[model samples]
Target: MGVQFGSFDSICETAALVICSLVGTAQGIEPSCYSRNVEVGGTIIFQPSTSFVHIVAIIMTAIMIFHIRSKYTAVGRKEIVMFFYMYIVIELLAMFLDSNIIPTANSSYPWFAAIYTGLVAAAYCCLLINGFVGFQFAEDGTPLSLWFMRIACLVVFGVSFFISIATFKGFAGFSYSKPIGLWIIYILWPIICAAVYVVSQLVLVFRTLEDRWPLGDIIFGAAFYTVGNVLLFAFSVTICDAIKHYIDGLFFFTLCMLLSVMMVYKYWDSITREDLEFSVGSKAAVWEVKDPLLSTGLDYSEEDTVSNYHGGGVAPSLVGGVSGQQLYQKGGMGGRGYPPSDRY
Candidate 1:
């Protein structure tokens, strides 16, 4: 049942109370979605389905990294590629956390979870920053822009890490029972970042680009992201029960998240183009062919004049003043061109 805010005297007070309740309520601690029956002296595998999804996400992220790197001339390549790297890290940590490979009782769980939380925050922060690259607020792909993004992500990661560790370890008066800080860092922060990124990208597309195809990519990404989170936070338990514990929201959530990331890549690739002259890929060569007979009003330098071909023996009119058509006439021994030696 949902909490009734109607009883509260004012909206501000109701908001305050809700915020207070969020403390020590690390809601990520949910029931295991599914587990496989594996017994080698009886050890049940936990959330194997979700773990498999994590593995797939990792592979997909690596593929995205390769593809993004290949676009050497694309704007914001370095900055956005960093997001996928962090994502890979997050998924690796999640595989261990969700699968219970790192047991909850393990003393390192809180530390690892804190690191994971921080990385997730950093990744989202990176995405939010990247959304503005098209605005040329600073030159994209420059060291200045790259470092700015790196430092911003680092600061966000550090703050998120502190909050998470404080909550998990019950330090700095952060109670394990009231993990509001973690809830904000882990859940609310990502949603805020995503909203900002989407808004910024929409502005970029509408205000800057002539082609609006990226809008579709943005829409698809937002849809996948929305569906993934909804499945995870709203209907995980219900789906878990409905599926007879075979799989749950986490699986679909992971899949949708992957699709969302792919859309991010698609949108970026759509907006950015390679300078083909400097591109690493092979390009067809086009040679210019000029017919000497048809060439007229051609200006030749002193070194290229027909005088050099005739060894100063031709008349002054036909020497340096010769037209391209006269230079190719049958005057020399070969009768095909002016000079038999082919100097002309």
Candidate 2:
């Protein structure tokens, strides 16, 4: 049954690919500026490379949903889940923009891109938040450094957001052949986010050195994304002739989502750890029994019960030399009020 489903999914994916290829061909992606070439009349063209990115986005989005629903968690994880939400939004917007264009100077493609920029910015914001929360929250506290990093990211985002709004950097097509200042506006957030992720990862490595196994998976996956983003940024800026950059898996975003999905899967509870003993404990306890893995909250009553059960037993008079029946006889220790026995 599972194999059948897998085959079915493969078939569906292939069908999707065929459809996308047709769409791209129909739109003249080969000569379209969206594919890195200018049309004769300046009509923006969608490229096959860009189409592949859309395919990747769709696949990863499906995988993300599977991971989230498998847990069946009904509450919390708002920030962590929000990261994926924004991820889907940004990816879909990229795909959606691929099929659209500013046919005229006054067309709405530019506006569409502008609105999408904010959503993408917000998505990257969640990614930063997840990075900090994943480590510090595991230890059951947020350090001053994490808080500082968060505040700094917000400031950067705010400044970048304003600049982008004023310049429509959200349109973000280097093919548009805009001036250098405007290009910087489009690339600002990616540079800043990648820088922050790399630094945050270093901090995580130091903080999690003691944890020998599980953290490695998350660390490596996140590193892949950070490094990929840096490389992608470089590639996008310098390698205009290469069509591979637009292909979904070849670009930074492919690395971003691929590694991110891995990290999310490996460390399924990045935001809140149910095993963190600090999250749940008795507040009114006079003392605490602390441990790295758990806490007892000085539960003396339970301790006493345990101790009593182990160290004590039934009454000697009732069970040892004297039986209950003999004890309850006339003139005995547990006797009725009657004539005394001669031995007593």
The prediction achieving the highest lDDT against the true structure is 1
**Roughly what TM-score does model 1 have, to 2 decimal places?**
0.75
Clashes of each: 6, 0
lDDT of 1 at 169: 65
Q: Locate the minimum summed-lDDT window of 10 residues in model 2.
A: 15-24
Residue range 229-310, candidate 2, lDDT tens digits: 5444334333334553344222444546566655755654453345333343435546665684456356565556424245
lDDT against true structure, model 1: 0.75
Clashes of 1: 6
- What's each prediction's TM-score? 0.75, 0.48
Model 2, C-alpha of 232: deviation from truth (Å) = 4.4
Model 2 per-residue lDDT at 14: 21
